[model samples]
Target: MQIVVFGLNHNTAPVEIRERLFFAESQAPHLLKTLRDRGIRESAVLSTCNRTEVYFCTDNADSSLAAIKEVLEKHFDVDRRILEGYTYTFRDESSYKHLFLVASGLDSMVVGEPQILGQVKDAYRMAVHSNTTGYLLNKLFHKTFNVAKRVRSETRIGYNPVSISSMAIELSKRIFGELHNRKVLVIGAGEMSETALKHLKKEGLSNIFIINRTFGNAKKLAEDIAGIPYPFESMSDLLGQVDMVLASTGAEKPLIEAGLVLQIMKRRKNRPLFIVDIAMPRDVDPSVNNIENVYLYDIDDLKDLSQKHLSDRLKESELALGIIDGEVAAFSSWLRQSEKNPLIAYVIDKAEAIRVKEFRKASQKLKNADEETIRNIEALTKAIVNKLVHPHVTLIKQDSDREISETIKRLFTPDEEDEKDLDNRNEGQ
Candidate 1:
């Protein structure tokens, strides 16, 4: 079976296009089952804010890709022509490399952000829960996770801890000059919002308000940050009061629209309102950025910070890629060695059969021979068999290239039947 990754990421598609493709946590199992029904036996859908990719193990790559494309079109209600422009397909080594890069955060918009690793782990768990992962995917993801951990630990890729949250804080500082004592309102108490709020708190921003669909979660985050907890219904009231807004809600539609921002700006009397939305299916609308005294930045807008430190990040990326390449070579070698097992097994079995048959024939012919003589003949035959097969064993165990293995296969009898044919010719001789 071949490893294939069919994906479209932030580089290929804009947020407007990607949001429509993002899969909810609850929808993962159903999606996996549908893929299985479509003859994609072992499959995983890694649907994050910036990308939605399907990784699968299949023998018929072309047919499976066609089927996956059909499902993507029907499921996302998008035309094939449009999806085709933004999508990419990878196979074998390229596919594995992409996976390793993604797990290590090298492929993310914010390189080495430290969140993509967890996102990948979550996607893997979903595949495991749905029973959509098999031998190949299980091994591949485990190794990918290990590689990611190694990159994080061994390299300086994540040393500075630059995430979207930190970027949001930087953007806020740029806008307001200082975050100290600024009343910041966080919409949604999810991980992203919590992280942004955490950074804001560290920046000495004191007045914070957290609103969530679930008041309990909002209260918990509010207590953690020593901020105020408010019901999500008070979002409009709090919007006008706060100097900045950090939104990371899971809402499918736009929660902060142009109309809402227009009203809020009017209430603030044109006081500047900076909003950073790190949500996947964006919490704020694109048109809201045009509002008077209202500045809005989405996940894509936050990636501008990565360019500022490109030189240092590039150095880290080179190191991380070196690690990935080493892992890929190791995996390839293991696969090659494993592929030769059947041939190795057959050759050994054939040699053993010959050794036993010759020993039996000698014992019958030398019945009048003394016990010690019989033992000597047996030991001699055993030694001869070992010497004869030793070179072949070395050839099999050597971690050579595919060409060498192919040559070895051709040089030896490929199957038991071929060995038997050679044995018959020797018997006739």
Candidate 2:
């Protein structure tokens, strides 16, 4: 099977296109099931504000790619031409390498942003829970999580708060000179809101008003962060009181329209109101920027700031790329070896089975053993199994002689009957 990824990202598409393709958490399972029904197995979808990507294992790359496009066209009602024009495809090494960069935050809009790692983990978990991921995808995602963790530990790329929230805060600081004693209204109780609120709190903002579509959610988040929570209906009333507004909600339509902002501006007597709409669909309307004394900055507005921040993270990014490259090489080698030799997998499985069987048998006899003793026994058995299987595995890899392969396969086979079964399977192959 070939490992492949095909989709559009922030670099390839604009916010409008990305939002159109964005898949919510609840929608991922349906997408995975659809791919499975279409014979594209072991699939996972990573849909964030910045990108929508599908990673899968398939025997025919062309057919699988077509199937994915068909799904997008049929399910999302997107134009096929748009997908063909905006999407990118990567195979084998390049495919997983892209995943590594994404999971490690190297591919984020704000490079070195830490939130993408959690988003990746959530995507993997959703796929696993949907039962769409098999051995290959399971291994790939686990390795991806490890790579992200390693990047965070080994490099300083994520040493500071270089996220969308931080960018908004920076822009706010530039406009206001200082956030101290400033009144800010945050519309959303999601991660983005929480992150931005934390930064604002550190900046000594005197009053932080948080509101959400769900009153309970906003109240809960306010309790957690020591902010004031008001009913969702009071958003407009709070708008006129705050000096700046940070909006990052999942509303389908613009929550703050140009007309509403116009009335709020009149209430503020033309006081300068900086509004940063960081949500995907954009919580604030674009025309709000045209309102006097009302400035609106949407998600796209952060691109230049993200680029400037990236320059400062270049060195750490290079180190993280070095780590990702090494991991890609290792994973690629393992994939190649396993794909080339089924007997190698069989041998390893057989050895593991033997080890487990022996360990269980010994465990029954060691009823009074301490936990440490039990762990040591398990490790000893595993080591013994590996040592016993090492030479045979090395031989099979070094020499691809069919007769030697058959001999080793037979030796590893459970018994005479299993050996016969192996022979039959080899013949069929």
Candidate 3:
């Protein structure tokens, strides 16, 4: 069977289009079941904010991709032509390599973000729970986890915080050293303020003061994220009390001018205050940065830092890509040999059967063996079986001669019933 992935990502589709086709966790099982009904048994769906992808092992890639598109069309009510316009398809090695990149966080919108790896794990778990993944998908996902782990341990791709929300937290940490018990004034209840506040919350800040144009919005946001809500008129009062201020509003002009902060800083005897203005029209005045003991960073400043961090991750990503390439080649080779060589399977099955039988007999003789002792025996037998079978399997894989294949086949030939059982197992896989 060929491994194929068909889907659209943030790179290929915009938010509006991607949202139209996004699948929720509850919907993934139904999607997998539908694919199974359509004759695509081994399948998984990974739907995230940035992308929605369906991975499957199918004998016919073309027909399988069509089946996925059809399902999307019927279930999500998106036109097939729209999918064809925005979607991408990769088969075999490319398909898995794409998965490796995605799982490793190299394919994320904010490169090196760690959330996608957890998302990938969640998707894989959902597929497994749905009974959709078989031998190939199970092996593929397990290997994918290993690859992601290796990339994380080997490279510093995800070492830095790159997103605006994360960068805001980073800046806060730099100023305050430890944000524990430190007060933060979030000067908006909009989406940007909410995102930055959520990031700040993770740092164990003592209190977050949220203010919005509408008092109700501030209260709602505060309740959702466990922050204190304040009226818009209380901005100046909250500014003097808090250690940091994060302003992201849709106002037409600068909300916090130099004069306002200058007065606030003077009231606290010029104590250090960090202000992050992420608004478009600039919530904090540019002259505010010139004020003594008042550190202000506009959206452009944060974007510059984000770009630098992204560049660093991109450099580290080269190393991660190298790791992925090696793994992809090795996994592809293993898949090829496993699919092409039934002799390998037969030998493994035969060896395992012998090992189990011998272990059972030995266990019977040692009637008083404890759990630990039985486990040790099991490990010992497995090691011995692997050691004994390794050389033969290696030789069979390396040799392309018919005589070598025939000799190995004859030596490990199972009985009629055993042969039929092995055939059935392979067929099912």
Q: Candidates' TM-scores?
A: 0.54, 0.57, 0.77
Model 1 misplacement above 4 A: 163-195, 198-310, 340-429
Worst 10 residues of 3 by lDDT: 417-426
Arrange candidates by TM-score, highest first: which order?
3, 2, 1
| Model 3 Cα lDDT, one tens digit per residue, 1-429 | 789999899999999999998989999999999989998978999999999999998877888888888988999998878899999999999999999999999999888889999999999989876778766787899899999999999999988878888888888778789999999888878888877777788889999999999899999999999999988998899899999998888999888888887899888788789999988988888998898878888899989988999999999999999999999999999998788976786687677667767887899999998989988999899899889988989998898798987777667765677657655656856
lDDT of 2 by residue, 1-429 (tens): 789999889999999889889889999999999999998867999999998999998878899999999998988898888899988999999999999999999998878888899999999988866767765787799899999999999998986545567777777877888888999988988887887788778989999898998999999999988989998899889998999988888989989888888898899898889998889899888988898777788878786666656776887899999999999999999888687886876687667666767787899999999999998998799789879999998999899998999889878887888777656645644
RMSD vs true structure, all candidates: 16.6, 10.3, 6.7
- Candidate 2 RMSD computed on C-alpha atoms after optimal superposition onto the true structure: 10.3
Top candidate, metric TM-score: 3
lDDT of candidate model 1 versus the reference? 0.83
Quote the positional error of residue 310 for candidate 2 in Å. 3.7
Instruction: Name the TM-score of candidate 3.
Output: 0.77
**Candidate 1, 40-68: lDDT as tens digits:** 97898899999999999886899999999
Best by lDDT: 3
Ranking by lDDT: 3, 2, 1
